[model samples]
Target: MSSRLARTSALTVAAVCGSALLVMTAVSASGNTAEEPRLHDIQGKTRISPFAGKQVTDVPGVVTAVRGFGKARGFWLQDPKPDDDPATSEGIFVFTGEKTPDVEAGDSIRISGEVAEFYPGGEEAGGQSVTQLTGAEWKAASKKKAKLPKAVGLGADRVPDAYAPEGKGDEGNIESLKLQPRKFALDLYESLEGMRAGLRNAPVTGPSTEFGELWVTADPGENPTPRGGTLYGAYDQHNGARMKVSSLLPREENHFPKADVGDELRGATTGPLDYDNFGGYTVRATAMGELKDNKLKRERTRKQSKDELSVATYNVENLSPESEPAKFERLSEALVKNLASPDIVALEEVQDDSGPQDDGTVAAGKTLKTLTDAIEKAGGPAYESRQIDPEDNADGGQPGGNIRVAFLYNPDRVDFTDRKGGDATTPVKVGDDGGKPKLSANPGRIEPQEEAWKESRKPLAGEFTFKGRQVFVVANHFSSKGGDQPMEGRFQPPVRESEKQRTAQAKLVNSFAKKVEAIDKDAAVIAAGDFNDFPFSPSLDAIREGGVLTSPMDELPADERYGYVFNGNSQVLDHAVTSPGVGPVKYDIVHINAEFHDQASDHDPSVVRMKP
Candidate 1:
C-alpha cells in the first residue's frame, strides 16, 4: 500500500482503465467514524472555510499543482465538478509538512485532514489568513491521467467594475466583508482564493525587480491613468483592482517576467490564488505569458525663462560625504537636465557628514559641498548652500544622521538675505524692520522645540532676493507616515497615526506664514519640501486653512499632478505651497525618478517657475 493509503481504511473500488482498478478511500487511524465531505462542502461560499476546525474523512480532488519549497509545503487540488455558486471556490490547498508530496498533477486523490486557517507573519501582523487542510491523509484514487479543471477567467467580464463594495463594513477585513462576487473585484478575489485562476492581457502597473512581483490590473479598468496604471484615490478601494503576481517557487527560472509601467502581460497568467503579508490576494503563477513593453520614457521639464525665478524641491534620500559619490553626480544631472537648474532648490534629507554613524557630528557642510561641486561639474550654475544643522540625533531620521532640510541657490540669480543669530535652536520670527516685514534671523528654524517637531526636522525658513524681489522660502521635511497600517491590513479604513504629527506641523507652518502675511499681505512666501503627506490629506488642508498659501499642484490637471508613485499609483508627497499673490506659475513634476527601477531618488523633483 502507498503512503497515501496508510492513514485511511474506508474504500470504494472503481475501474478507471479496462485492466487497472482504482480505489477511492477514506480512513482514520484514530478510529473515528466520520462521513466523507466534498471540497465545496468544506469550502462554503465565504472568505473562510465553513469546516475550518473540523476533521473530515474524504475530500476528493484532482492534483493541479505542487509547491514543495516553502515552509508550508502544499499541493493545490481542484474538484472536477464545481458548485453552481460563484462565491464558493472549487479548489483547496493540502499542507504536506516538510516532506514533498508523492502526488503529481493530473492524479485524482481523496484527502482526509483537519481544516485550519493559517495566518502568515503570525496573527499579530493583522494580515489576511489562508485556509488549508493540515495533518492530512490521502490516497490516490487513480494514477491514470485526469484532466485538470479549466482555469477561471479573470478578465474584465469576470472581474467586477468596482474594486470593493460601497458600504459601512470593514473593507480591509477580507473575511468579514459582505461577499458581493458580482459587484466588487475584492469580493470576487476573496471568493476565489485557493482556486486556479487566469488573467488575460493584464497590464502591469508596478514592476518589482527585487521580488519579481508584477502589480497588474486586468483590462477595462475605470479611471486608467495615462501611464497605464490605475489611479489610487484617497480611499483604499482602488487597490482592489490591482493584484500582485508572483511564482510559487521563489527561483530565478520560475520568477514572474520582468516588466515596467505601461507594459502588459499578454496571454494567460495561470496561477493559484493565495493571500500573503505583502499583498492581500496574490496569484502564485504556475505559468506566465510574454512581457510586452510599452517603452515608457522619462520626461524633463521645460527650461524656465532666465527672468522667471525657478524654485524646486527634492528629497535626496539621505545624502552625505560618506555616501556614494555617484549618487551626487546623478542627482546633479537630474537637477541640471530635468529641472533646468532651478534658481533655488530646497533639498531634504541631507545627512550629517558621517551619514548614519552615531558619533554626534551634526554639520552637513561637506555633504552640501560635494553636491554643489557635482552640480557645477555637470554644467549647472555653481550653487551656494545654506542650512542650520540640527542638534545631534534630535531630528528623527537615521539615528545620528541629523538629516535636515537645506537650500541651494544659484548666486548669479538669487541672493540669500544674511542676518545674525541663525542657529539650530533659534526660532525665526516675522518682525517689522523699519515698517517692512523682515526675518529677525534669516535662515532660521521655525519653532524647533515645539512638541510636533520634537523628533522631526524643523522647518527651515530662509530669506532670499530673486531678481531684486524679496521672497521668503520655508523648506520642510515633515514626519513620515511610517507607523500607518497598510491599506491591505485587517483594519478597515486603515489608520494613519502619523497624520497627527504632520497636521500639527502643517498648522505651525501655516501660522508662521500668516505672520509673514500680516507684516506684508503680499509677501512672496514659498513653502516647499517633502510634507510626507498627500495633497488631499488633512495635513495639506491644515496648511491651506487660512488661505495664506495654496498648493501649486492645484493648478495642474488632476491626472498630472503627481510627484511620487507608491504601490503602483502615481501620487504626490512633495509639494510647493505659495502665497496667494505669487504668480501665474509654471509648475512641473519632473519625471526623472519614482517610475524607473534605476532611480537616483525615490521622489521626483517638483519645479515651480514664476517671477518672484
Candidate 2:
C-alpha cells in the first residue's frame, strides 16, 4: 500500500493505468484529470484486483463520513450511479470503502482502485463479491462532470457483523419480538444499559421493561448447555431494549479495557456476544442501555444538500404515537427536530390503524398517518407514508399496535411504485417463537427449523427511483434471541434444512427480482433494508455471490459494517442488494439514527445512493 492508499485507510489499490477511456496522454502522479470519461464502456476501461492488489486510476465522488471500528476506520463515500444496478456505468456510481477517509458525502473527489467481490467462507471472511473498490488514491477528480444516468444506481448488499448465521437473516423466533411492545412499559431495574467497554463484571443499572435481556450458559460444558449462571451485564440489544440480565460468566474478549465496572456505558450500542470455549462455549451480551430520564432531549433535523440527501432510521425511544396520541405527538415533533427528514426514510416498529384495543373504529389503525401528519406539523416537508396494516391478531408491542414496516418519502424528490399485499410466496416465515417449528398439517413448517433459522431472517422487498434510477431495496430484522425448540429448551444444532432459512429468503428475493425482470428483463433490483444477518450466512451467500449483485458495504470499515453490536462483535444486518447494472456508487453511514435508540429500536437505518 502506498502513502495514498495508507492515507485512504485499509483499501487495497489495483493497477490498470491505461484502462480509462478518453484520458489525455499527459498524466501526473496525482492522477487528477479534467476530462470526464464515459461510463457505458466501464468494463473495457476499468480494472480491479482480486485482493490486496493495486489499481492505478481515479474515480470522482465525495466522502460521506468516517466510522471507527478499532484500529482501522471505514470510509463511506457517495459516488454517482451509472444505472440502477447496471454495470454499464452510464452515470455517476456511488462507492464506499473499508479503509479510511479521503472524501466526504458532499465532496466531489475521484479515486482509482481495484474492485473485488466478497463471499462467506470465500475471501476476506465477508466482503463485496464484485467491485471491492480498494487501493483508493483520493484527489479532486470531477466537478459537475457528465449528467447522471437514469437507470444507474449502486448495489445494496451487506453482511451482519453481529447476530448472524447462527441467528440472523433467516427465520427464527425473535425473543425481542415479545419485547417489541412495552417500549417504555418494560421493567428492567438492575442491568447494564448502553455500550460498556473494557470490563468484565459491569454493575447493574435501574431496571426497565424492555427486551435486550437474554439467556446463556455460563458453563457450556455443564449438564445443560445453557445452565443459567451469573448475570452478564446488560450490553446486548442491537438498538435498545428493556432487559433483565441476572447471570453471567467471564469472557477473555474485552475490546474496551478502559470500560469501567459501572458507568452506564454509553456510546454506540454494543454486545450480547456469544463465545466458544473449546467444544463448549459461553454466551454474553451487549446492552443497548438501561432506561434513562431525558430532560434535555433533542431530535435529528433534516438537512438536504445539493446532489445529496441525508436519511436516518431508528426505533424512536418510547415514541409509540398511537399508544398515547397526545404524547406521541410531542415525541413526533421531537423526532422531526432531531432526526432529519431525508428524501426517503424506511422505518420499522411503526403503528398501523389497528386502533388502541382492536376495536372496530374506522380509524382504528391509521397509526402511520397520525405520526406522519404530526411530523409534518412539526416543521418538516410533506411526506407520503406506506405500511401494512399489522395482523390484528398478533399481540405485538402496544395493545393492537402493528409491528409493520413503513417507508415515508418526499414525493417531490423521488418516485415510488406501490407494491404490497401481493400474497407472493415467502421462502419461510419467522418461527412462532425463535424455536423449532410445531408439527402441523401444513406442507411448510410453521416454526423455522432451529438449525436453519439461525442463518437469516424473512426479508421485505421494494424498489425506489432516485433521480430516475430505480433501485431495489429490502428491509429486514433478523432473529434476536438464540434458543432451542421451545418446551424442549437445549443447545442443539438445527437440522441442516434449518440453514435453508437463508436460502429461502434469498430465493424469495430472487423471485422478486424475476418479477421485475418480467416487467423489464434489464431492470436492476436494489434490495435494501435490514437483513438481520451477516455476510457469510448461507442466506446471503446464495445470492449472486458469483460476480452478480454488488455489496458496497463490504468495502466499508469493519466495526462500521454493523449497524449495531452484540456482546461486542459488530454485525451488519441492514443491507442493499442491487441487480447488475446498479452499484459501484458512493455509500456512507447516516449515523444520526443510532443515537436515539438506547432503549428505542434494536436496529439502525442504512441507505445508499447513485445518480441517474
Cα deviation in Å at residue 85, candidate 1? 1.8
How does model 2 fare in lDDT? 0.37
Report the C-alpha displacement of residue 319, candidate 2, in angstroms.
7.2
RMSD in Å for model 2: 26.7
Where does candidate 1 clash, by residue pair? 8-27, 9-27
- Per-residue lDDT over 100-168 for candidate 1, one digit per residue giving the tens place of the 0 to 100 score: 888887889998987765555444455555667778899988869898788888776677766654334
Q: Which stretches of candidate 2 lie over 4 Å from their true place?
A: 1-304, 308-321, 324-339, 355-365, 390-402, 417-463, 474-499, 514-524, 543-548, 567-570, 590-598
TM-score of 2: 0.43
lDDT of 2 by residue, 478-522 (tens): 433232121111111122333355565565555545544545544
Name the candidate that leads on TM-score.
1
TM-score of each: 0.86, 0.43
